[model samples]
Structure formats: structure tokens, C-alpha cells
Target: MSASNHKDTYQATGVFLVLMGILYLLDKWIGFSSHGLPWVMQKDTMLLYAAVIFLWFKSDKSVGIILAGIWLIQNIGLVIALLGQMSAYLLPLALLLVGVILYFISSR
Candidate 1:
């Protein structure tokens, strides 16, 4: 690839990795979550970041697939939490949209 293309790709991937790092830190540092919301040590969030790392080292398309899968599952739980009688539905809604947006960008 051209220098510019490589730089652009690196920039994108670097940003993604940084974001994942931030999430991991937040999950570790901030301990505030119930059962439904995506929190630290949770499977969905952990998987998302792990996929990010994997994709960064593996392939972009593969990362996209992993992100999409994680987001899909989170989005479903978010919907259920919001529409159903649940506690603190706001966080899930936010997390759901974030996951969807991230995977959307990754996938396409």
C-alpha cells in the first residue's frame, strides 16, 4: 500500500485499539453495574475488546464480523431491558448504540 494509505489504515486501527483500551480500563477501574448493563468483566464487553485486539493483529474483515456479532447480542439485550420492566435501562441503550455504531463502521 501507499504511504498515505498505510498511514490512514494505521490511524484507524490505532484509534480502535485506543478505544478498546479505554473500555477495558473503565471496566477495570469503574465498578458500577448490575446484571443487565454491559460492565467490566462482562462477556459482551470483554469479547468486544478482545475482538478488537484480534482484528488489529489478524484481519479487518474478521474484526468486523466479531464486532457485529458482539453488537448484535448487546443490542438485543438492550432492547429487552428498555422495553421490558427492568432497572436502569439507560446504560444498556447507550452501550447498545455504541456497539452497533462501532461494528457498523468496522463491518463497512
Candidate 2:
């Protein structure tokens, strides 16, 4: 991508982060109930959103994949609880998937 394109991507990401921050602040200060809010609006979803944005807009995707993997690792307990004991296998499966994806991306 050209310099202008990178600049636009950065600007868009900055705007998105700013908007998320504003919403978070509003939720804290105004005591707005977040229960009815969409999953994307939740605080913990920011990293996932950022990862997706980076993967979509940037030429290099490893950072985005790493971020996404980190998010998944951090939320493993929750995932397991939701999916049951069999879900424990998902951790290794996810790691393998990430590794394969990274390998393919890096080989290109």
C-alpha cells in the first residue's frame, strides 16, 4: 500500500479506538447498563476488534493473528465453561491452527 493508504488505515483505527473509549467512558460515568449492548461494545472485545481491523487493513497479518490468539488464550476458561469439558481440546486445536496460518503467511 501507498503512504496515503497507510495513513488512512491509521486514521480509521484511531477513530475507532477513540469511539470505543468514549463509549467506555460514558458507560462508566453515566452508569448506562451494558447488558443490552452488543458484544462488540463490550470492553473485552476491543482487542478482537483491533486484531480484525489490523488484519483487514495492514499488509502484514501476523500481529493481528497474534492478538487474536492472545485474546482466545485469555478467554479460554470462559470458552471451556461455555462449551464443556470437551472444549479443552480446542486450545491445542486453536494453537495448531494459528501455527499453520502463521507458517503459510510467513512462507509467502
lDDT to native, each model:
0.64, 0.74
Q: Which ranges in model 2 have alpha carbons more than 4 Å from their true place?
A: 1-5, 33-43, 104-108
**Candidate 1 accuracy as lDDT:** 0.64
Compute each candidate's TM-score over C-alphas: 0.37, 0.61
- lDDT by residue (37-86, candidate 2, tens digit) is 56545555887777777777666666677887788777877888998977
**Clash count of each predicted structure:** 0, 0
Which candidate number maximizes lDDT?
2
Backbone clash tally (model 2): 0
lDDT of model number 2: 0.74
Which regions of candidate 1 are displaced past 4 Å? 32-35, 39-108
